[model samples]
Target: MPVWGWILIAVIVVIAVVAVIVARLVSSRQRTERLRGRFGPEYERTVGEVGNLDAAEDELAARERKREKLDIVSLPPEARAKYADSWRTVQIEFVDNPSSAVGAADRLVIQVMRERGYPIDDFDQRAADISVDHPKVVENYRRAHSIYLAQEQGDVGTEDQREAFVHYRALFEQLLETDENKDKPKETRA
Candidate 1:
Protein backbone atom coordinates (compact mmCIF):
# COMPACT_ATOMS: atom_id res chain seq x y z
CA MET A 1 0.00 0.00 0.00
CA PRO A 2 1.08 3.59 -0.60
CA VAL A 3 2.31 5.48 2.50
CA TRP A 4 -0.49 8.09 2.26
CA GLY A 5 -3.14 5.37 2.04
CA TRP A 6 -1.70 3.60 5.10
CA ILE A 7 -1.77 6.88 7.10
CA LEU A 8 -5.35 7.59 6.03
CA ILE A 9 -6.49 4.14 7.21
CA ALA A 10 -4.77 4.63 10.56
CA VAL A 11 -6.52 8.01 11.02
CA ILE A 12 -9.89 6.48 10.22
CA VAL A 13 -9.38 3.72 12.78
CA VAL A 14 -8.40 6.26 15.45
CA ILE A 15 -11.48 8.36 14.80
CA ALA A 16 -13.72 5.33 15.07
CA VAL A 17 -12.16 4.38 18.41
CA VAL A 18 -12.54 7.93 19.73
CA ALA A 19 -16.16 8.03 18.65
CA VAL A 20 -16.88 4.79 20.46
CA ILE A 21 -15.25 6.11 23.62
CA VAL A 22 -17.26 9.35 23.49
CA ALA A 23 -20.49 7.45 22.92
CA ARG A 24 -19.82 5.16 25.87
CA LEU A 25 -19.03 8.03 28.20
CA VAL A 26 -22.18 9.83 27.20
CA SER A 27 -24.22 6.68 27.79
CA SER A 28 -22.71 6.11 31.22
CA ARG A 29 -23.42 9.67 32.27
CA GLN A 30 -27.01 9.41 31.13
CA ARG A 31 -27.58 6.19 33.05
CA THR A 32 -26.14 7.73 36.16
CA GLU A 33 -28.40 10.75 35.87
CA ARG A 34 -31.52 8.71 35.24
CA LEU A 35 -30.92 6.38 38.19
CA ARG A 36 -29.99 9.21 40.50
CA GLY A 37 -33.10 11.15 39.56
CA ARG A 38 -35.36 8.18 40.10
CA PHE A 39 -33.85 6.93 43.31
CA GLY A 40 -33.07 10.32 44.82
CA PRO A 41 -31.14 9.95 48.10
CA GLU A 42 -31.48 6.18 47.87
CA TYR A 43 -29.08 6.37 44.93
CA GLU A 44 -26.42 8.08 47.03
CA ARG A 45 -26.91 5.75 49.98
CA THR A 46 -26.73 2.62 47.85
CA VAL A 47 -23.56 3.87 46.14
CA GLY A 48 -22.05 4.59 49.53
CA GLU A 49 -23.05 1.12 50.74
CA VAL A 50 -21.77 -0.70 47.66
CA GLY A 51 -18.73 1.55 47.31
CA ASN A 52 -18.94 1.31 43.51
CA LEU A 53 -21.02 3.43 41.18
CA ASP A 54 -21.61 0.70 38.60
CA ALA A 55 -22.58 -1.92 41.15
CA ALA A 56 -24.96 0.40 42.99
CA GLU A 57 -26.59 1.49 39.76
CA ASP A 58 -26.95 -2.12 38.79
CA GLU A 59 -28.65 -2.91 42.08
CA LEU A 60 -31.04 -0.01 41.72
CA ALA A 61 -31.77 -1.01 38.14
CA ALA A 62 -32.54 -4.51 39.32
CA ARG A 63 -35.04 -3.10 41.80
CA GLU A 64 -36.77 -1.33 38.94
CA ARG A 65 -36.93 -4.56 36.98
CA LYS A 66 -38.27 -6.54 39.92
CA ARG A 67 -40.86 -3.89 40.64
CA GLU A 68 -42.03 -4.02 37.05
CA LYS A 69 -42.94 -7.67 37.52
CA LEU A 70 -44.99 -7.02 40.63
CA ASP A 71 -48.69 -6.09 40.54
CA ILE A 72 -48.52 -3.02 42.76
CA VAL A 73 -51.67 -0.95 42.77
CA SER A 74 -53.12 2.04 44.57
CA LEU A 75 -55.68 1.45 47.32
CA PRO A 76 -59.29 2.21 46.48
CA PRO A 77 -60.62 5.34 48.07
CA GLU A 78 -62.66 3.41 50.65
CA ALA A 79 -59.71 1.21 51.58
CA ARG A 80 -57.44 4.19 51.74
CA ALA A 81 -59.85 5.91 54.03
CA LYS A 82 -60.17 2.87 56.25
CA TYR A 83 -56.42 2.59 56.60
CA ALA A 84 -56.14 6.26 57.37
CA ASP A 85 -58.67 5.79 60.12
CA SER A 86 -56.68 2.86 61.46
CA TRP A 87 -53.55 4.98 61.43
CA ARG A 88 -55.32 7.67 63.42
CA THR A 89 -56.27 5.10 66.03
CA VAL A 90 -52.68 3.95 66.23
CA GLN A 91 -51.60 7.52 66.80
CA ILE A 92 -54.12 7.95 69.53
CA GLU A 93 -52.85 4.81 71.24
CA PHE A 94 -49.34 6.20 71.05
CA VAL A 95 -50.23 8.56 73.90
CA ASP A 96 -50.68 5.69 76.34
CA ASN A 97 -48.60 2.93 74.77
CA PRO A 98 -45.89 4.24 72.49
CA SER A 99 -44.12 0.91 72.18
CA SER A 100 -47.25 -0.92 71.18
CA ALA A 101 -48.19 1.91 68.89
CA VAL A 102 -44.88 1.51 67.08
CA GLY A 103 -45.57 -2.18 66.62
CA ALA A 104 -49.05 -1.48 65.33
CA ALA A 105 -47.65 1.07 62.92
CA ASP A 106 -45.18 -1.44 61.55
CA ARG A 107 -47.91 -4.01 61.04
CA LEU A 108 -50.16 -1.41 59.45
CA VAL A 109 -47.48 -0.45 56.98
CA ILE A 110 -46.91 -4.06 56.06
CA GLN A 111 -50.63 -4.65 55.66
CA VAL A 112 -50.86 -1.68 53.33
CA MET A 113 -47.99 -3.06 51.29
CA ARG A 114 -49.55 -6.49 51.14
CA GLU A 115 -52.90 -5.11 50.15
CA ARG A 116 -51.24 -2.97 47.49
CA GLY A 117 -49.66 -6.11 45.95
CA TYR A 118 -46.16 -5.83 47.40
CA PRO A 119 -44.62 -9.02 48.73
CA ILE A 120 -44.06 -9.02 52.48
CA ASP A 121 -42.25 -12.27 53.08
CA ASP A 122 -39.01 -10.49 53.99
CA PHE A 123 -38.29 -7.03 55.30
CA ASP A 124 -35.11 -6.39 53.33
CA GLN A 125 -36.61 -7.58 50.08
CA ARG A 126 -39.80 -5.64 50.78
CA ALA A 127 -37.76 -2.46 51.30
CA ALA A 128 -35.85 -3.05 48.06
CA ASP A 129 -39.08 -3.43 46.13
CA ILE A 130 -40.62 -0.42 47.82
CA SER A 131 -37.54 1.63 47.02
CA VAL A 132 -38.26 1.36 43.32
CA ASP A 133 -41.46 3.41 43.60
CA HIS A 134 -40.95 5.14 46.94
CA PRO A 135 -37.26 5.87 47.09
CA LYS A 136 -37.59 8.84 49.42
CA VAL A 137 -39.41 6.83 52.11
CA VAL A 138 -37.65 3.48 51.86
CA GLU A 139 -34.93 4.83 54.08
CA ASN A 140 -37.63 5.88 56.49
CA TYR A 141 -39.00 2.36 56.34
CA ARG A 142 -35.58 1.01 57.21
CA ARG A 143 -35.16 3.39 60.07
CA ALA A 144 -38.59 2.51 61.40
CA HIS A 145 -37.95 -1.21 61.10
CA SER A 146 -34.72 -0.84 62.99
CA ILE A 147 -36.55 1.03 65.68
CA TYR A 148 -39.20 -1.67 65.81
CA LEU A 149 -36.48 -4.26 66.29
CA ALA A 150 -34.96 -2.20 69.07
CA GLN A 151 -38.37 -1.77 70.61
CA GLU A 152 -38.80 -5.51 70.65
CA GLN A 153 -35.64 -5.65 72.72
CA GLY A 154 -37.08 -2.96 75.01
CA ASP A 155 -33.97 -0.86 74.45
CA VAL A 156 -35.77 1.97 72.67
CA GLY A 157 -37.16 4.99 74.50
CA THR A 158 -40.50 6.69 73.97
CA GLU A 159 -38.84 9.26 71.75
CA ASP A 160 -37.41 6.55 69.51
CA GLN A 161 -40.79 4.86 69.34
CA ARG A 162 -42.32 8.13 68.32
CA GLU A 163 -39.69 8.51 65.63
CA ALA A 164 -40.51 5.05 64.32
CA PHE A 165 -44.18 5.93 64.17
CA VAL A 166 -43.32 9.04 62.19
CA HIS A 167 -41.23 7.05 59.73
CA TYR A 168 -44.04 4.54 59.26
CA ARG A 169 -46.39 7.45 58.68
CA ALA A 170 -44.11 8.75 55.93
CA LEU A 171 -44.29 5.48 54.06
CA PHE A 172 -47.97 5.06 54.85
CA GLU A 173 -48.88 8.44 53.45
CA GLN A 174 -46.96 7.79 50.26
CA LEU A 175 -48.64 4.44 49.83
CA LEU A 176 -52.00 6.07 50.37
CA GLU A 177 -51.55 8.70 47.66
CA THR A 178 -52.76 8.12 44.10
CA ASP A 179 -53.74 10.27 41.14
CA GLU A 180 -57.39 9.50 41.65
CA ASN A 181 -57.52 11.02 45.11
CA LYS A 182 -54.39 13.11 45.51
CA ASP A 183 -56.27 16.36 45.20
CA LYS A 184 -59.08 15.37 47.55
CA PRO A 185 -59.34 16.88 51.00
CA LYS A 186 -57.56 14.83 53.66
CA GLU A 187 -60.87 13.89 55.23
CA THR A 188 -62.23 12.67 51.88
CA ARG A 189 -59.14 10.74 50.78
CA ALA A 190 -60.80 7.64 52.01
Candidate 2:
Protein backbone atom coordinates (compact mmCIF):
# COMPACT_ATOMS: atom_id res chain seq x y z
CA MET A 1 0.00 0.00 0.00
CA PRO A 2 2.99 2.32 0.54
CA VAL A 3 5.92 3.37 -1.73
CA TRP A 4 8.33 0.71 -0.38
CA GLY A 5 5.76 -2.09 -0.86
CA TRP A 6 5.14 -1.00 -4.50
CA ILE A 7 8.93 -0.87 -5.18
CA LEU A 8 9.40 -4.44 -3.85
CA ILE A 9 6.53 -5.75 -6.00
CA ALA A 10 7.98 -4.13 -9.15
CA VAL A 11 11.43 -5.64 -8.48
CA ILE A 12 9.92 -9.09 -8.02
CA VAL A 13 8.00 -8.81 -11.27
CA VAL A 14 11.13 -7.77 -13.17
CA ILE A 15 13.08 -10.66 -11.70
CA ALA A 16 10.41 -13.15 -12.75
CA VAL A 17 10.44 -11.81 -16.33
CA VAL A 18 14.21 -12.05 -16.52
CA ALA A 19 14.12 -15.60 -15.21
CA VAL A 20 11.62 -16.59 -17.88
CA ILE A 21 13.72 -15.06 -20.61
CA VAL A 22 16.83 -16.92 -19.42
CA ALA A 23 14.98 -20.20 -19.30
CA ARG A 24 13.75 -19.77 -22.88
CA LEU A 25 17.21 -18.86 -24.17
CA VAL A 26 18.70 -21.93 -22.50
CA SER A 27 16.03 -24.14 -24.03
CA SER A 28 16.58 -22.78 -27.54
CA ARG A 29 20.35 -23.23 -27.23
CA GLN A 30 19.97 -26.84 -26.11
CA ARG A 31 17.65 -27.62 -29.02
CA THR A 32 20.09 -26.08 -31.49
CA GLU A 33 22.95 -28.11 -30.08
CA ARG A 34 21.03 -31.39 -30.16
CA LEU A 35 19.90 -30.85 -33.74
CA ARG A 36 23.39 -29.87 -34.85
CA GLY A 37 24.87 -32.98 -33.26
CA ARG A 38 22.33 -35.32 -34.75
CA PHE A 39 22.02 -33.78 -38.23
CA GLY A 40 25.68 -32.78 -38.83
CA PRO A 41 26.02 -31.27 -42.33
CA GLU A 42 22.32 -31.73 -42.91
CA TYR A 43 21.65 -29.21 -40.17
CA GLU A 44 23.72 -26.55 -41.91
CA ARG A 45 22.08 -27.33 -45.24
CA THR A 46 18.60 -27.07 -43.78
CA VAL A 47 19.39 -23.77 -42.10
CA GLY A 48 20.82 -22.41 -45.31
CA GLU A 49 17.74 -23.44 -47.26
CA VAL A 50 15.22 -22.21 -44.71
CA GLY A 51 17.13 -18.96 -44.06
CA ASN A 52 16.33 -18.95 -40.37
CA LEU A 53 17.58 -20.96 -37.42
CA ASP A 54 14.16 -21.48 -35.87
CA ALA A 55 12.53 -22.49 -39.14
CA ALA A 56 15.30 -24.93 -39.98
CA GLU A 57 15.07 -26.50 -36.55
CA ASP A 58 11.33 -26.68 -36.90
CA GLU A 59 11.65 -28.44 -40.26
CA LEU A 60 14.18 -30.90 -38.90
CA ALA A 61 11.98 -31.61 -35.89
CA ALA A 62 9.05 -32.21 -38.20
CA ARG A 63 11.10 -34.73 -40.16
CA GLU A 64 11.93 -36.59 -36.98
CA ARG A 65 8.31 -36.64 -35.93
CA LYS A 66 7.19 -37.85 -39.33
CA ARG A 67 9.79 -40.60 -39.31
CA GLU A 68 8.77 -41.75 -35.85
CA LYS A 69 5.31 -42.61 -37.12
CA LEU A 70 6.64 -44.87 -39.86
CA ASP A 71 7.33 -48.62 -39.66
CA ILE A 72 10.91 -48.49 -40.81
CA VAL A 73 12.74 -51.75 -40.25
CA SER A 74 16.11 -53.23 -41.05
CA LEU A 75 16.72 -55.75 -43.82
CA PRO A 76 16.61 -59.42 -42.91
CA PRO A 77 19.92 -61.26 -43.10
CA GLU A 78 19.14 -62.95 -46.40
CA ALA A 79 17.89 -59.76 -47.95
CA ARG A 80 20.98 -57.98 -46.75
CA ALA A 81 23.16 -60.58 -48.40
CA LYS A 82 21.24 -60.33 -51.65
CA TYR A 83 21.53 -56.55 -51.68
CA ALA A 84 25.25 -56.82 -51.03
CA ASP A 85 25.68 -59.18 -53.96
CA SER A 86 23.58 -56.94 -56.15
CA TRP A 87 25.72 -53.98 -55.18
CA ARG A 88 28.86 -55.89 -56.13
CA THR A 89 27.39 -56.57 -59.55
CA VAL A 90 26.50 -52.93 -60.00
CA GLN A 91 29.98 -51.84 -58.99
CA ILE A 92 31.54 -54.22 -61.49
CA GLU A 93 29.20 -52.95 -64.18
CA PHE A 94 30.51 -49.46 -63.49
CA VAL A 95 33.83 -50.44 -65.05
CA ASP A 96 32.33 -50.91 -68.53
CA ASN A 97 29.06 -48.96 -68.47
CA PRO A 98 29.48 -46.10 -66.09
CA SER A 99 26.27 -44.27 -66.98
CA SER A 100 24.09 -47.33 -66.69
CA ALA A 101 25.94 -48.33 -63.59
CA VAL A 102 25.17 -45.04 -61.86
CA GLY A 103 21.52 -45.35 -62.75
CA ALA A 104 21.49 -48.88 -61.39
CA ALA A 105 23.12 -47.63 -58.25
CA ASP A 106 20.35 -45.08 -57.87
CA ARG A 107 17.68 -47.71 -58.33
CA LEU A 108 19.45 -50.07 -55.97
CA VAL A 109 19.63 -47.41 -53.30
CA ILE A 110 15.92 -46.68 -53.71
CA GLN A 111 15.14 -50.37 -53.51
CA VAL A 112 17.14 -50.70 -50.35
CA MET A 113 15.25 -47.76 -48.93
CA ARG A 114 11.95 -49.30 -49.93
CA GLU A 115 12.93 -52.60 -48.35
CA ARG A 116 13.82 -50.69 -45.22
CA GLY A 117 10.23 -49.30 -45.09
CA TYR A 118 10.99 -45.87 -46.51
CA PRO A 119 8.62 -44.34 -49.03
CA ILE A 120 10.20 -44.47 -52.50
CA ASP A 121 7.68 -42.44 -54.46
CA ASP A 122 9.33 -39.05 -54.05
CA PHE A 123 13.04 -38.38 -54.21
CA ASP A 124 13.11 -35.16 -52.18
CA GLN A 125 10.83 -36.49 -49.49
CA ARG A 126 12.72 -39.76 -49.42
CA ALA A 127 15.96 -37.89 -48.90
CA ALA A 128 14.44 -35.82 -46.11
CA ASP A 129 12.99 -38.86 -44.39
CA ILE A 130 16.23 -40.77 -44.74
CA SER A 131 18.09 -37.81 -43.32
CA VAL A 132 16.39 -38.46 -39.99
CA ASP A 133 18.18 -41.77 -39.57
CA HIS A 134 21.11 -41.39 -41.94
CA PRO A 135 21.99 -37.73 -41.68
CA LYS A 136 25.61 -38.06 -42.73
CA VAL A 137 24.90 -39.79 -46.05
CA VAL A 138 21.81 -37.96 -47.27
CA GLU A 139 23.93 -35.32 -48.96
CA ASN A 140 25.70 -38.03 -50.86
CA TYR A 141 22.31 -39.28 -51.99
CA ARG A 142 21.45 -35.79 -53.24
CA ARG A 143 24.69 -35.42 -55.13
CA ALA A 144 24.28 -38.86 -56.66
CA HIS A 145 20.73 -38.10 -57.67
CA SER A 146 21.78 -34.83 -59.28
CA ILE A 147 24.47 -36.56 -61.25
CA TYR A 148 22.06 -39.25 -62.33
CA LEU A 149 19.68 -36.60 -63.62
CA ALA A 150 22.48 -34.86 -65.46
CA GLN A 151 23.60 -38.13 -66.99
CA GLU A 152 20.17 -38.67 -68.46
CA GLN A 153 20.56 -35.34 -70.23
CA GLY A 154 23.94 -36.47 -71.62
CA ASP A 155 25.67 -33.55 -69.94
CA VAL A 156 27.76 -35.41 -67.35
CA GLY A 157 31.29 -36.67 -68.04
CA THR A 158 32.77 -40.04 -67.13
CA GLU A 159 34.51 -38.47 -64.16
CA ASP A 160 31.23 -37.03 -62.91
CA GLN A 161 29.56 -40.37 -63.42
CA ARG A 162 32.25 -42.03 -61.36
CA GLU A 163 31.81 -39.47 -58.62
CA ALA A 164 28.08 -40.11 -58.66
CA PHE A 165 28.63 -43.85 -58.31
CA VAL A 166 30.95 -43.26 -55.39
CA HIS A 167 28.38 -40.99 -53.81
CA TYR A 168 25.72 -43.64 -54.31
CA ARG A 169 28.04 -46.15 -52.69
CA ALA A 170 28.32 -43.93 -49.65
CA LEU A 171 24.55 -43.89 -49.27
CA PHE A 172 24.18 -47.53 -50.20
CA GLU A 173 26.68 -48.43 -47.55
CA GLN A 174 24.78 -46.27 -45.10
CA LEU A 175 21.45 -47.78 -46.09
CA LEU A 176 22.84 -51.26 -45.51
CA GLU A 177 23.63 -50.34 -41.93
CA THR A 178 20.87 -50.45 -39.34
CA ASP A 179 20.99 -49.20 -35.81
CA GLU A 180 21.50 -52.69 -34.47
CA ASN A 181 24.56 -53.45 -36.61
CA LYS A 182 26.00 -49.98 -37.08
CA ASP A 183 28.57 -50.25 -34.33
CA LYS A 184 30.43 -53.16 -35.86
CA PRO A 185 33.18 -52.41 -38.32
CA LYS A 186 32.48 -52.49 -42.04
CA GLU A 187 33.86 -55.35 -44.14
CA THR A 188 36.49 -54.62 -46.79
CA ARG A 189 35.24 -54.52 -50.37
CA ALA A 190 36.92 -56.28 -53.28
Measured against the true structure, the TM-scores of the candidates, in listed sequence, are 0.93, 0.93
Candidate 1, residue 147: Cα displacement in angstroms equals: 0.4
- The parts of candidate 1 lying over 4 Å away from their true place are 178-190
lDDT of 1 by residue, 115-153 (tens): 999999999999999888888888989998999999898
Report RMSD (Å) for each prediction in the order shown. 3.6, 2.5
- The runs of at least 3 residues in candidate 2 whose Cα sits more than 4 Å from the true structure, single-residue gaps closed, are 178-190
What lDDT score is found at residue 56 in candidate 2?
100
Worst 10 residues of 1 by lDDT: 181-190
Question: What's the lDDT for candidate 1?
Answer: 0.88
Top-TM-score structure, candidate number: 2
